[model samples]
Target: MTAELGGRIREARIARGLSLRAMAAEADISPSLLSQVETGKVQPSVSTLWAIVTCLGLSIDEVLGHSPASREPLRVEHPNPIQRARDAPEIVVENGVTWRGLAVMDPNVDAVLVTYAPGAASSPDDTHMRHPGTEYGYLIRGELTLKIDFETYLIRAGDSFCFSSSRPHLFRNDTDAVAEGVWFVAGRAGAASARSAPGPVRDAVDALDAMSRLPRRVGG
Candidate 1:
């Protein structure tokens, strides 16, 4: 998955006629780091990936291989609302964060079951990510640390929270146990109820799509 993701990112960079150095500069990252990320030698943090995607003008869905061209249009009539556990698509990101799509066909929203392993965090370097949207989450198990700007809150099981994505927030699991939750992100990238999926899903799908093209590792 890492290799495949790197290849796709490299492909997108080339397709846009941007040099590695230029792209790295645009993304506020070092050229060597970008090169490592593109070659699969490094696993980029969520914030780093977000920066790259935003710089390349590529949606996350496109990265995940869930592009509009790859999926049939969702039909209002006879909609299949059931997403079986076996059929749900899941992806692992930087650190030990995992996201399983709960409503994969929804284009205007991203609803996923998220899990954070012990010590796992949304960003590797404690950086926050700010985007245009709103986030609603319900913690299902364990504990999570939510940091918004300079404020920090400890979220416990059964506790829910809502915040604007533009607040530069980050999530982390500081306990020994895994933290799980249901997360919904809406209005990302100003995406509306259109035929195409919203930005967050599209973005996540893009990352997952790259993973689908690669061979699974032992115990991955």
Candidate 2:
């Protein structure tokens, strides 16, 4: 599996027209180091892997090959009597932020349940960045400092937020508490969510997204 992962990484890098040296430069590492990584001669730390993947504009799920089920028939994750943690797949960011999802499809939308350890962040810093879509977030527990378009907003448990992904957005949890949240992003690939989400939850989410745009709304 490890070798396969490395092979996929190398394939993705080449498919993007990046040479080993070019990719090394892009990932801010030496060509020798990147070559070792590609050949699985060395195992990259989570942060190093993250830098390589994001630098190539690929999501961890894509790099790890977790976007297949998403392309299959729509799946309804019905409410279970108990929310048992599945050995289901996940994508880790710096080994601190864990994103568990069935798939991370960029075309339809990328929805994930994310958990952050204390002091963890969506990225290293408040770097200005944006996805090609809209974003909706609901904090399940703890608190977070969400920065959008350079403005920081304190979001706590039960708080939700929605905004155009066109603006730069960043997230971090400075509090000494584990934070968990649900994020829904859409608009680039296709209107898949509109067709996949089941009835009540779908309607409720849409309503919430609409209300989030209103002044002083809780969803905002």
Candidate 3:
């Protein structure tokens, strides 16, 4: 249970886009100690836990309140297959990428079915962004490109991939045809502020600070 508590804190920190160092500084704890606590090497005092919770701007009560991950029963259902509809709640995050959420909402992850118009990219301008936890996607009926840091991958229909959300990553549809995919991101809802870069991979405060130092173009 102690280890579970530590892992919960770490997950929340990751989801908040906070690295061990930044969280430690804010919590007035040493980074090494925090790392040890997160790895279950050492137990934290109640005060220490409170400080961490305060710095992360989230509560661990949900994670500690239940052991659902182990004992919770999974729901089984066969709904008339989900179909994309014109009136469905959809958001165009960029010129080419449209997201429509799925019906299922789990505590550990969020689901979205996405449609990509030609030349659509989750990361516009070729800039990378990070998030918390992990990401999984399956190409349902089109081709899409995945970029993690500097590496690029081509995903076609029926192909699925998962990766750490902490790494700078994005998706693009550069083909002539529209593409569709089912996407899942492992993190609690509103895990990070909208202004923050989207991902669950690493310390986001540091990434944002670094981005601020880059020279700005007068106009794109």
Candidate 4:
């Protein structure tokens, strides 16, 4: 699955005529790290994956093998509202975080059950992720540390929080026990928002072209 994901990212970058360095720069990552991610030599953290997809103008669904056309068939074939646990798509990101999708075809919002193993973190580096959206999360078990910009809050089980995703934030499990939670994200830049919105394709192409033209940074 990791290799396949890498292949999809690589294909999308090439399709947009973006160099490895250019895409990495746009994603605010090192070119060597991006190359490793593209080759499946390493798996990216949740934040890194989100950044890469946003830079490539590709939806997380597409990267996860759920294209828009492919999703149509699912809606037509099964109109059931309840999703079976066995059928839920689960993605394990870098560190020890896991995401399980709750809905099959919801375009306006992304609902997922997230699990963070002991010592898990949303990002490997100090940089946090900021996107155009709002995030609501409820901690179901254990403890989690939520860092928003310069502030940090310790969240315990039964605690629920809502915040704008545009603020740089990171989630971490500092305790020895695992942390589990359900998160709902909605906005113009959520997981599926870019693909559902009109003109994203063109905008992505233009952005890629513009970024590709910039000279590579020294020692970057």
Report the number of the highest-TM-score candidate. 1
Computed on alpha carbons, the lDDT of every model, listed in order, comes to 0.68, 0.62, 0.62, 0.67
Over all chains combined, what TM-score does candidate 4 have? 0.53
State the lDDT of candidate 4 residue by residue for 1-220, as single tens digits: 8888899999999998999998787677999989988898889897788888777655677787874543211221244566677765565665677777665343445566888899888766545766545789999999999998789999999999998665668888899999999987664322443334333212212222222222221110
1-220 in candidate 2: lDDT tens per residue?
A: 5677788899988897989987787566789988888887888887677667655655556666666444332333443422234633455565267766533323345566878799887655535544345788899999998888658999999999998654556778899999999888765332222222333211222232222222220110
Q: Give residue 100's error in model 3 in angstroms.
A: 0.6
Clashing pairs in 4: none
Per-prediction backbone clash count: 13, 1, 10, 0
List candidate 4 stretches off by more than 4 Å.
1-77, 188-220
| Residue range 1-220, candidate 3, lDDT tens digits | 7788779888988998998898897676899989988888888886676567646644345545452233221322335444345423445563556666454424455566878888877765756655445778899987988888779999999999998665667777889999998887665333332233343222222222222222222211
Taking every candidate in turn, the Cα RMSD to the unseen true structure, in Å, is 11.8, 13.3, 12.8, 15.3
Better of 3 and 4 by TM-score: 4
Candidate 2 regions exceeding 4 Å error are 1-87, 102-107, 189-220
* Best prediction by lDDT: 1
